[model samples]
Target: MSRSPLEKFRTIFKRSSSNSSRSNSTQSENNSLTMGGENYDYDEPPLTPLELHGYKSTTKHRLLNKELAEELRQHVPALLQISHDWELLYSIEQSGTSLQTLYDKCQPQIGESVNRRRGYLIVVQDTRKNIFGAYINEHLRPLDKKIYYGNGDCFLWKLEKGDVKDLNNKHQSIEKKEVSLNLKVFPFTSVNDFVIYSNNQFISVGSGDGKFGLWIDSNLSIGASDSVDTFGNEPLSDRKKFYILGLEIWKIC
Candidate 1:
């Protein structure tokens, strides 16, 4: 049967509309599967670093919680009879403080004592309020040189926070779920610049940039001769930027 041109156009439009509807349905189903459920909406925002790193509950707080701090302290052993009572060395409420400034403040604490090795701990709170820290087994000295190395015991750990009640009753009041330690010295420089601790002392920590590297006595000193310490071929600026919430230098007194 010969149909009018207008009728043919109407038929084509109907077929196109049906195909479009089927395509949209298929896409919606695919999206639902990707999102983990049909009820999940794609319009919802993505998970932030804090949420992803298990800091969902305390992300809003600028200061680190006591429970979490205690948990982090557990990882640092009191080597050579050093007390667990950590003393502060330096801090910056905001960014833009030079590494040299921190070193100057730390110098007096480190002292000229060759008899007792000093251990240092640096805790930084990022903009997201996620707390991370590192430990240096030896006291950092003001150096005329731009680099120093550390022994192999240096490592970094990320504090994993979770609901204490979820674990066994033994962990009832503890919010720290786990401490993920990376023993491998982070490859920061071409030769892995770090402080070498003698007398059986060692420490390590994750940098502000989330990389593992030991604290070095390079350009950090007030009168460091070099313009910048060579961390491999990378610029000093490539190094991690941290807002020092707290710095502690503990001597084996």
Candidate 2:
């Protein structure tokens, strides 16, 4: 039986059952080659030692500088006020029946007292002549316990002999002195025995017979027992004897 042209073409193109499996296997191999073989993943280049070190150093330096700048900017105003207040306290003569009396005598020129106006500046002169003091921003109340913490706006400062002269000797014509102490103002929250007062506002320094103390009346509250004592672990009551040379209270307007 002779087939027609169309039938003959179909038969020649048809895949026989036996050869179908072989054809599929060959096609899979061809596809694998075209797809760039089995291992075709990309990899990132590794960093060199110099590049790694440089990146670390730059990041560290940037973080440090930022921290320092932020701290200085935040505390500049407080520092200025502290210095001004110190000058006022320094100029006053240390003569009074008691710390409270001294404070009453040296009130700064703060205008009207509308709100609960209360503030104080306390200075202690050790036998060695070193001077240090604190400024409290509120009326201090009597505490039942020997160890009392202070609150409100309170900051402590120290006047080194070297810095004091430089601070005083600056050109008188200048509105403000160019010299500034490295002294940083410590808040009440950062200290332990901030306003150690039983009957009055006072701070005890030293322990034994020579221990010294200062008394004043300013509203201030120190931190709780757990708070960080920026001064140190040695209680203020443990230090040697000292004298209260100056104490002043001002009504903050």
How do all models score by TM-score? Answer: 0.40, 0.38
Provide the clashing-pair count of each candidate structure: 10, 17
List residue ranges in candidate 2 displaced over 4 A: 1-95, 103-118, 140-149, 165-180, 190-240, 244-251
Model 2 lDDT per residue over 29-102, tens place: 33321121221112223322111011122121111111112222233333332322122232223233453444
Q: Which ten residues in a row have the lowest lDDT in candidate 1?
A: 220-229
Q: Over the full model, what C-alpha lDDT does candidate 2 score relative to the true structure?
A: 0.34
Clashes of 1: 10
Q: Predict model 1's lDDT versus the native.
A: 0.36
> Per-model C-alpha lDDT, please?
0.36, 0.34
* lDDT by residue (tens digit), candidate 1, 81-164: 234344445444322244555555556444465666555555443332223445556555444443445544443433333222
C-alpha lDDT (0 to 100) for residue 26 of candidate 2? 42
